[model samples]
Target chain A: MSENMGNKVSLELYRTQLLARYFEQRASDLFLENLVKGTNHLALGQEAVAAGFGVAMNKSDYTYCTYRGHTHTLVRGAPVAPMLGELMGRECGILGGKGGSMHLTSVEHGAMGSYAIIGAQLCIALGSAWSAQYLGTDQVTTVFFGDGTTNIGTFHEALNMAAVWKLPVVFVCENNLYMEYTPIGKVTAVEHPGADRASAYGLDSIIVDGNDADAVYHAAQDAYARARAGDGPSLIECKTYRHQGHSRADPGKYRPKEEVEAWFARDPISMYRLRMMENGFTDEDLTEMETEIQNTIDEATEVAKLSPVPSLDIIDKDVWADGGSAWRN
Target chain B: MAQLTYREAVAEGIAQEMRRDNNVVFLGEDIAAAGGVFKATVGLFEEFGEKRVIDTPISENAILGAAMGAAMTGLKPIAEIMFSDFLAVCWDMVVNEIAKARYMTNGQVKVPLVIRTANGGGSRFGAQHSQSVENWAMAVPGIKVVAPSNPSDVKGLLAAAIRDPDPVLFFEHKSLYAMKGEVPNGEHVLELGKASVLRQGDDATIVALAAMVPRAVKAAEILATKGIEVTVVDVRSLVPLDTQTILAETVKTGRLFTVEENPRLCGWGSEISSIVTEECFYDLDAPVIRITTPHVPLPSSDNLEDATIPTVERIVETILKNMG
Candidate 1:
């Protein structure tokens, strides 16, 4: 935990972490019931990284992340009902059911977008940073990706360009150790997938205990400050673990039992909960917070279940700014 | 009116928009100090300065991704993909990100940007550097595809594309870069989705785009000597196609022949042929013929390259053979 963080900030982090954890839990349950259609990549064990960055970021700063971005979107203050409704493909969803779980976006809240293509957002995020610099705004752009993305060409291209231009941006890698079904270490030449490559781009190699919210919050603060101060980009690698399989379909049978157990023991939400109790927080207070999260999740689930599927009229709508997909005038 | 080369028109078009709106900016590989490899954007860096007219590393993904992000936020960026063939290098950024951002986000984001690339194969730069990939852009939804034939259309159409609220892929034909033509003076902006009828005749209507327009026009001239007068229609924009004009011209002549620089399969002409067949089937005096490059990679050799793409002689021969 960082010494600079106040008790109030710590409690808020705990609440947001719980909110993400509970929302995903409900989402997992809904997926089994066939309520949430298609595939979903939940940030089950990576709540701290999202929560920390979410709290640390300004409302004006832009955020671009990968498909594992439900937690990030929620942390940006998107209402739970609409987000859940989006997963359910309902008309009242955040994107009006146009974009599914993997592509969650809220431009109004500065949550730019969640790209499914690996390493693409890193390049896209640079544009927002460039725009800020060109328009003379102090707003910083942050992009988050998985450890697997380090091997992709766009990652290298984006980093090189971002470094050359000294764009106001931060690249955060949530190194959960697995690249879909393959272990990242087997394919990667470097030890630290993201951090080790930082020096190559004229950036500091930063690695943080991703399970620690305070640590991530402080790291995020430093990166954001540097970006806002026009000191160029920073690449941070958060060493974390995902509790669930890559997606809902996988059972994660390939992993060794002992490795899974070790990661499970360091679950971010539980660790944060215990730390809160040690710092003058009661079990009752934590339990009350959990109950509040449960109620919010319950209400959001009900609203999502009741929401109607998108109308057929909107199928061709939004293909252009004219609200029609007509190719011929 | 000032006579400008197609390459000069490109710089003028970008300069016009950049001067008019502060939000409009230009970036690409060698586009700044080097004035673009094609020399199309010369003097832009001196006029616009470094902040607005910027040079980027040879990273297609970064160049386009940055353009997309800028467009989504506020700026109307004009990004050059040196060669149209290079679009394949950053296909995902162009198709997945830039094209679909607006639709996927339910209009929360608008990518008001132009990806200007030197398209087509008259330079014999081999298959890698030369390709008329406007059809590739046309196949994708939510992207406006424009390929200007003349210097005048280049300036006007490019201005329209930059001002458009959606993403536009502007294809400036490599062969037409040095071709000079009179450009309308001052703030010229032509409406997209409108085809230009460069010539009028009653026997047959020839539809062409970009480099093929000049060939088709020359073919019409040569065929005129043989008493087979033909109307030439330049299909300027592909996505928001001017179907009404195409149908009107085809219906008037009662015969249609499409001349395309793209390969035979799924070329822009195929779409026009399908449209003409569906709407003006009864009005046709003869089968709608399509004159296009054979389905093969453009060869680097001059003779092979010239034979592959539709030439004036080939267009005239095809028209003469099909006009019966």
Candidate 2:
């Protein structure tokens, strides 16, 4: 299928992708230079996705994503300074420096949380969607997870429950084709992943070229609409790839060099940039956008670096909400 | 005040909270039409309907995860796990997700979910249905565990757990469902982490939990005839333990005995024993004795099952043995 689904692709969407790309790029530099001070998995090649679905939902709509969440959060309007500050373990971070890269959560931005436990984020997203319906709110929640999560028990449990209850949720499988350096083909039996599995739950599912921001936005819009209309849950599997390795430490040497090169050539950022140029955007216009994003990220990084590390006294705090605790000892 | 069974009290507790707070809802397998296998949720389905009293598919893990998710949002979800043995199947959801959310989020979110599960033996349902999971609940952090012995405590704690700003594990003994006691009419919300001293004595302090509370009470009656005075303390809440109440009683008595239905090794008694020993080490006149079942799975046979659970006879005998 062509990247465009007959709808006019917005330049604003392209700008969102650019912002996500720049954010991930800066994070990469920070992680590589050891300035971020934590292990992280950067969503390098997956810029279109982070921006596509991020901007597709309304402000009241919630999101639940995997550990590679900075790009998703940035595109969803989470403040860069606080997010980066969180990465640096500063008190000014989004979670007050408690949740680092893998566990970022923003209630203001409707980001429920990012989880390191494989399929947990997706499962929790169903709960939020159930809450929306239970409380008579039309707000929908989009659960983003790697295709690798589809094989897990939580995926089946969540999808089954969402289908039965008619939860306002859109399950987005960002199939990056790998699960921690292992090919999905080796680990998974199903070729279509979420698309194939969703049928078992009597859910409508679609496959999208995840590199195309317009395609994801359109798919997400349809799911969100059906959800808001009380039509129950659906699945959208986006075929994408992560540009970075599984984590900061690994070089992803297991992947064939040719495969990496092929994916690198079709980098979502460059493709979107090319599409913009063809659509009457100038080199100077692109440069201005890039420079502006760079400068903003630079200031954010500096602020994150300067922010004070979280106090150790708060280490024992927040265990319970009623000033009671289970882990005090 | 009205006399009601333990199951009736629990059902009333849920119903009263649902009436008071629109945010409170119920979800469990067969809890709607069947009124729960143990009938702990009887009449709630018709009173609350499908939205409030939801009958979920038989998925324990999903129930726990979804409840946490709902609690993090606006709804105060009371999820019924049916049996406490199934709790081990979804232990990750309890220990990892429910227990760690608020702390990991730096207090940004609170999971006010009440996980109600049938616990303990004596109904002859075999090992799976017969488990006292206070040890499991108390072992986890960021979770409040409540196992009320009588009808009154169940009613008050159920309402309290729904209103609590944290997650709670409400363990219900299978045998105690039909057990009757006087329950106060209308909004009765008990404070979590407060112990109820059922019987007052000065010779020794007996900290009893869940089903063991009633057993300890019976044991106190039996011990009184032998010229031995025993104080039976019902430890209503395990996680947010009322250490002050327990400590004061232990200091007054100078001898303490922890009673639970769980295994002796790494059970809730060990934690209580540690607390009393650490706090009242000098006040101790005798070695703190823990009365618990042997570390073994509950058997299916009537005679076998009887040998595993803590009983009044066992409590009385253990108290007598410890006194010397």
Candidate 3:
């Protein structure tokens, strides 16, 4: 736990982390039951990183993330029903099921969009930050991606431009040790994929304990303050691990058993729960929050199940602003 | 009315929008102080100042991605990709990100930005720097593609693209930048998806875009002396295509000839031919002939480049042969 974080903020972080954890667990179960179609990238063990940034960020600040962004979207205050419904391909989904699991977006809540392509949102997020800076607004833009994205070209392009322009943006790299099936270290030259490259872009190398919510919150707060104060962009590398596979299809058999168990012992949700208790939170207080989160997830799942599938009539709609895909007029 | 070069109109068009709306900002490499590599965007930096008219590093992906982000937020940005051929460097941003952002989000986001690139061949800059790629933007579902033939259309269409609610790719022909024509005094915004009939005739209809439009018109003039008066239709915008004007002219003349600067295979003319065949199949007096450059990379040598692209003589000869 950090000294700067108040008890109330810590509890809120704990609650958000619990919400993300429970929601993803239900989402996984729904995927197994065939209620969720296509493929989904779950963020089961990376709750602290999402919760930390989510709680610390201002409501107006924009967020961009990769395909594994369910937790990021939830932390931005998007209702779980539409998010799960989107995964279920229902009309009531956030994007009306037009953007499947990989492309979740809720612009109204400042959760810009989850890009399926690696390192794409990195460049896209620059525009939002540029908009803020150009308009003279204090709104900061934060973009999150996995460790694998550090090798992509856009990562370098975006970082260079952001620094040159001195745009108010923060780049967060959630290094979950694995990029899809391959270990990130195998392909990457540097030990810290994101942090190691920060000096080249003239940015500070910020490394955080992503498993600890307080540590993440402090890091996020510092980055946001620097961005708001016109200090350009900051790259923070968070060391975390994902409990599940890259997607629903793989079982992640490539990883050794000992590594999985060791990561499991330092589970973000369990660690946060213990931290809350150490901060004078009663067992009843924590249990009550957990029960509430479970009920919320249960209700969200039911709502998603009841939501109807999108109709074929809208197949050609929304292609243009006029609500029709008419190329020749 | 004022006579302006196509390159000067590029600057005027952007300056007009920036003057009207504070949200309108422009960015690209050497665009601000240097006034663009082609010198087409001259005076934008001086008039709008450094904040509104910014310069960027040579990062196509970042340029377009940042434009998309700015457009979605509040600012209406105009990003220059230097050359249309360089769009390949940022194809993912244009095709996967900018083009699909609106539809993928179910219209929750609106990317109202313009990507201005110097397109087409004529300067003999070689295949890498001189390929015509309007068809690339046209194939994308959400993007609006506009290619103007003359200075007046450049100002009008560029202004219209800036005001459009969707992402627009404004293709300024590298060959026509030096050409001069009369433009309206102020705020000349033309509607997209509308073709301009440069010359009217009943014998035959010649359709062209960008650099080909002037060549097609010259071909019509030469054919007029030979008593073969053909209607010249300048396809100003490709996406949201003016099919009605194209079909009407084709049906009126009972013949259609497309002068395309792009390569032979799967060019914009192919789509026009298919549409005409489906709609005006019976109205045609002869098969639709497309006067196109052969499928090959544009060479740097002036002789090879001129021979590669469809010339005024080629259009005239092709039409004269096809009329028989």
Q: Compared with the true structure, what per-residue lDDT tens digits does model 1 show for residues B1-324?
A: 999999999999999998899999999999999999989999999999999999998899999999999998999999999999999999999999999998898889899999999999889899998889999999999899999999999999999999999999999999898999999999999999999999999999999999999999999999999999899999999989999999999999999999998898999999999999999899999999999999999999999899899999999998889877
TM-score of model 3 (CA atoms):
0.99
RMSD of 2: 2.5
TM-score of chain A of each: 0.97, 0.93, 0.98
The regions of model 3 sitting more than 4 angstroms off are A1-5
The residue pairs in collision within model 3 are none
- Model-by-model DockQ, in order: 0.87, 0.61, 0.87
Give me the overall lDDT of model 3.
Answer: 0.93
DockQ of 1: 0.87
Model 2, A8: alpha-carbon shift in Å?
A: 10
**TM-score, candidate 2, chain B alone:** 0.98
Chain A, model 3: TM: 0.98
At residue A168, give the lDDT of candidate 1.
Answer: 92
Better of 1 and 2 by DockQ: 1
